[model samples]
Target: MIRETYVLVERELKKWVGRRGTFFISLITPIAWLALFGKSLNFVNMFSSAGLQGANPVIVKQYVDQTLLRLFGTTNYFAYLATGMFVVFAFFQSVFGGVNIVFEKRLGSMNRLRMTPAPRSSIFLAKMAATLVRTFFYETILLVIAVALGFSVDWNAINFIEAGAAIALLAAGFISIFEAIGFAVDNQEIMFSIVNLINLPLMFASPALFPLQQMPWWLRDIARFNPLTYAVDIVRYNLLGVHSFNILEDWAILIAITAVFVTAGLLASLRVLENY
Candidate 1:
């Protein structure tokens, strides 16, 4: 199984490397967010320009700190925003896990592989592993861009290790969910449609680009149940020295969610393969 999974991982990586343009384009979303949106997000400026008519500077300062900085735990909004981009990049990579399988099916590659002695589980594992590796590659690039744009991330070895683990687990869980969706649907268009339906809502509802406290009451309630919210909090706590939620509790929830999705994804992949 290890050998078979490794082979699949290699194949996936090769495909990613060959499509350099696609890989880079996928990365542009996070970079653009940090470069353009992060630097420009300022409610204070907007409020001031709206002419509150000589409001006390101290009151304005306090409002900014409490409303925005409190949510992010940072004066530098870029750092806060960049940290959330990890999940965004992870989601992008994971969303395509099963799409690869669909393409292989169309190309008859999957049929050829099933003719071999390779276990069906191995095929799915290989794709999962490949997605993980791909995510890491894109995430690293995004981090470099963030740092270049003056986003501060914690570099303490212990913190970095813990944060990396959290990221891996988050990616694993999301990848499994998407992979399951891909396997269950034969048509790539339908799979992508389902993905699109869920992706943007999940991103907006989570405290990724915006803080939870600033959202409407209903959106905040919805965010409470979003796994990406937990992912963002865990990563921010570890990497940005921000602890909006209990770190230990967040990790527990994230792990539990990952386990459920991974199990479902494995079962779905196996069932799909049996049919193929």
Candidate 2:
């Protein structure tokens, strides 16, 4: 099964790499958010322009920086937002992980794949592995861009690995769910509709774009139930020293939820594939 999964994953990655246009185009959205939107939300600059320039500029800067520190755990809002975007970029890629499966199914490749001796579970595992590889590649590029745009982080190796692992698991969880959806559905449009419906709401509802404390109570309640909220907390704590939840608790819940998602999604996809 491991060998079969490896070959299948290689095929998927090779196919993905061949599509140069799509890979580069997929990068534009996160770059825009990190470069333009990330820097634009700086509270220090906002307060500076809001007539606080008349006061001793140093005092005003200190005041705004301190307030931002309290609100975001760092005075550099771009760093806060960039870490969030790291998880979010993985998110967007993971959400689309099953897109190729949908296409393969439609083009008769899925049925062909089932004719092989490879276990149905390997089929799912290969797709998940391949998507994670692709996601991590893009994440590396995005991180480089973030660094160039004034996003700072602890210069520590453990922090880098932990943040990467947190994102990989989070991406795996989402990829499993979407991969099951790909196997279960016949039409590509249904997969797209589901992605569109949940993607933005998930991003907005979590601390991905704003602090959870800044949100209304009802919204905060909803975010508490979101796996993304935990994922972001884990990433932020390791990468930026900014977090809302206990690091250990966040890891526990994230692992529990991701375990459930992976189990359910694999079983469901295998069931659907068996029927075909």
Candidate 3:
């Protein structure tokens, strides 16, 4: 199984490399977020002001010490925003990859592949792997830039490993959900439209730019229920060693969501292929 998976992954990687334009375009979103959005996210103090004012001075000091200042290992607000931007980029890549799948289906590539002797699971796994690799590539480039810009992180082996695993899991879950949508949709344009429509809202609804505790009560509740929130939280924890909840609980929720979404994607893709 491992060998077969590698073979399929290699094939997908070749295709990805061959499409230079597509690959460059994929980097644009992450670059824009890192360069543009990262600058605009300097309102962290404003966002946290209300919560800070309402809390006891000592408690506020502790919160700032534990979360914003100490947890991130830096007092720079941009570094904190960079962590959230990385998560957003990962989720966006996965969701956008689903549109590519829909395009491939419309182009009849999916049907041609289906008629081949290759295992169906191999194809699904290959797509997921591609999404993961692409996301990692884009995010790593952004991180390098962030580091160059003076964003300091704990350069430990454990943090690096955890960050990679967290990103992979988050990408897998997001791709799974979007792949299900691709299976259900018949048109590439419609799929693209739907994905873009949800993109901004998902970012805004999550704790991407600021902590959930800083949000209004209604928004905070909504963000708490968002899977992207968990991904952002875990990434922040891994990158900065600061967490909003128990580390074990965050990992469990992320793993569970990945499983559910992967299962749903497989069922949906299989049903659609079978009918085709």
Quick one: ranking by TM-score, best first? Answer: 2, 1, 3
As a TM-score, model 3 comes out at: 0.85
User: Model-by-model lDDT, in order?
Assistant: 0.81, 0.90, 0.78
Error of 1 at 259 (Å): 0.5
Regions of candidate 1 where Cα sits further than 4 Å from its true position: 42-44, 52-67
Top model number, TM-score: 2
Tens digits of per-residue lDDT for model 2 on 1-276?
999999999988898989989888889989999888987786666788898777887888899889889989988888888989999999999977777788998999888899999999989999999999999999999989999989877789999899888898899999999999988888999889998998999999999988999999999999999888998998999988889989999999989989999999999999998887
Per-residue lDDT tens digits for candidate 3, residues 1-276, read: 566667878877888888889877877876776678776654345546766556566665555556656434546667778888888888888886688788888898888878877777777777888778878887888889888766788888888788778778888987987877887798978987898798888898987777777778999888877778888777888887666877788889889988988898888877776776
Clashes of each: 0, 0, 0
Model 2's alpha-carbon lDDT is: 0.90
Predicted structure 3: lDDT: 0.78
RMSD (Cα, Å) for all candidates, in order, is: 2.2, 1.2, 5.2
* Candidate ranking (lDDT, best to worst): 2, 1, 3
Displacement of residue 105 (Cα, Å) in model 2 is 1.4
Residue-level error in angstroms, candidate 1, position 56: 9.9
Worst 10 residues of 2 by lDDT: 39-48
> TM-score for every candidate vs. truth?
0.91, 0.97, 0.85
Q: Summarize candidate 1's per-residue lDDT along 1-276 as a digit string, tens digits.
A: 899888878987898899878886787777778888987877677667778548986787677777666666777777788878787678767887877777877788878988878788888898899888888878888888888888776588897777678788878987887777776777888887888898899989988887888899999999988888898888888888876678888988989988998998889878978987
